[model samples]
Target: MLTCDHPFPLDQYDDRVKEHLRFTGFYHASQIGIVQCQKALVNALVERWHPNTHTFHLPIGECAVTLEDMAMILGLPTDGLPVTGITMSNFETLEAECLHQFEIAPRKSNYRGSGIKLTWLRDLKERLQLTDENNIQSIGQYSWGSACLAHLYRALCRASRFDCKEIDDPLTLLLVWAWIRLPYLAPVPREPRSFPLANM
Candidate 1:
């Protein structure tokens, strides 16, 4: 399974930045601790995934993660502008966006095709300041929950392919959703679920 290990240091931010995060619907998501993925369970679930229907084919019935699950599990906004944009664009545009969003210019070495390394993102989180208040706050206008669900669906579709050997994406959301809905397949939560269900 492919995993993403970039953890945000939310506590390092000041109250102002923290408030911005809450305002942008990311505070609860940022609170989620590292989840212990059960690879066997995940593999089993993937085997049941139906890319055509975007649902799991279980003996009981078909079920799938929805926008509501994204909101409940990750505290991301479910309603707003869709998270759609030009992904593969000119390097100059990409550089401009990076500078606008994180206020740091990335070197060409940071490029991975059209995107920069996750390390750059992690570095920005460590040093991000709300210098451009409106610009940063504008991100709160997008439906991040929808974006997450879309990404998960796309990842599932690709991973379910016959020759696909590994799954890549944030598996935490999927695992948590499964844990909540399919208890028999879940690990016992280390503690009670907090505000965002992923915090369990």
Candidate 2:
């Protein structure tokens, strides 16, 4: 139930990405902290996913997404090493990100934001067993609706059988979508990336 029929926005980064981190109850980074924490996050995630590398396509605005470009965009270090489509923890955790910035009053009479695509995320949040006692929607609005894609990718990873120390397969992208697209914890930009999802 971790993922179903959705894709994680592995490449997207919101300008207020820290707000998403806050959703996971991780809002202690300042300007430097923002950059530092993101770098740390990327390093930790990349290390875990290094074993699974995929030759996937990544398109940036008006250009192809190189590792350096990704580093610049996401505040990651340019180690010259390629990146996995995903990394880090799944959406379910003790972490709780507050939703004041998103104008989400989970405790209010009614919550906000709606769209046909968003229905999947709302469902995914329920599947993850998150609550809304403290204006906590778990998933925020930074990301339009990429969880459904991640869900689908997770299914693919589960179905694929690959052995390591043999053929190098970038199957982590398929495997770690849920972990990477964690609602607010894994917030993407409110505005869609200029790159097309189909390009990937």
Candidate 3:
């Protein structure tokens, strides 16, 4: 799994953002390429989501517009968006909101070390299957997990610039969560471990 100790640097140039999104996990999965899907997603966002301000930096890197701002920009009603009680105060709240939306069970009390497993991947794929295939295919020929992760990473990356104030639709947020969180749980290695001769 990719280990990013810090949040992505949204203050950087567009090229830098593109590089991080595309090449960071380029070869991690065979189902689809990260770079290709990112471009497609960007295109969709550009076409569908209008920025509140006339300046690109204002909308893209400084602060995210709230759901109200989004509605104003898109000329849509805000009544349809669900208001999440969790705020972006910290990672825990963000994670909790995501877990709740995906219906991922909490960690067992008896759990010992790292809880990563194949079951997470299975559950993620199942959720993706419930989404529209056209939406899924727009990104790439990615598995449910890969597509979900890409979307989440992009959303968070976009959210980072906006002081974590963006209000997206609950369904949209759920989809992004599935993409971002699912890929982090890498498939468990199947090969057996070898023991040292000294142990025998």
Ranking by TM-score: 1, 3, 2
**Which lDDT tens digits does candidate 1 get at residues 120-154?**
77777666556777876888999999999988888
Q: lDDT for model 3, on a 0 to 1 scale?
A: 0.33
RMSD of each: 2.6, 16.3, 18.9
Candidate 1 lDDT score at position 57: 91
Which candidate number would show the highest TM-score if scored against the true structure? 1
TM-score of each: 0.84, 0.18, 0.21
lDDT for position 89 in model 2: 38
Pairs clashing in candidate 3? Answer: 63-162, 64-162, 148-179, 148-180, 149-179, 149-180
Report the CA-based lDDT of candidate 2 relative to the real structure.
Answer: 0.30
Mark the regions of model 1 whose C-alpha exceeds 4 Å error after superposition: 1-11, 89-93, 99-105
State the C-alpha lDDT per candidate: 0.80, 0.30, 0.33
| 2 against 3, candidate with superior TM-score | 3
lDDT winner: 1
The runs of at least 3 residues in candidate 3 whose Cα sits more than 4 Å from the true structure, single-residue gaps closed, are 1-35, 38-78, 87-104, 108-200
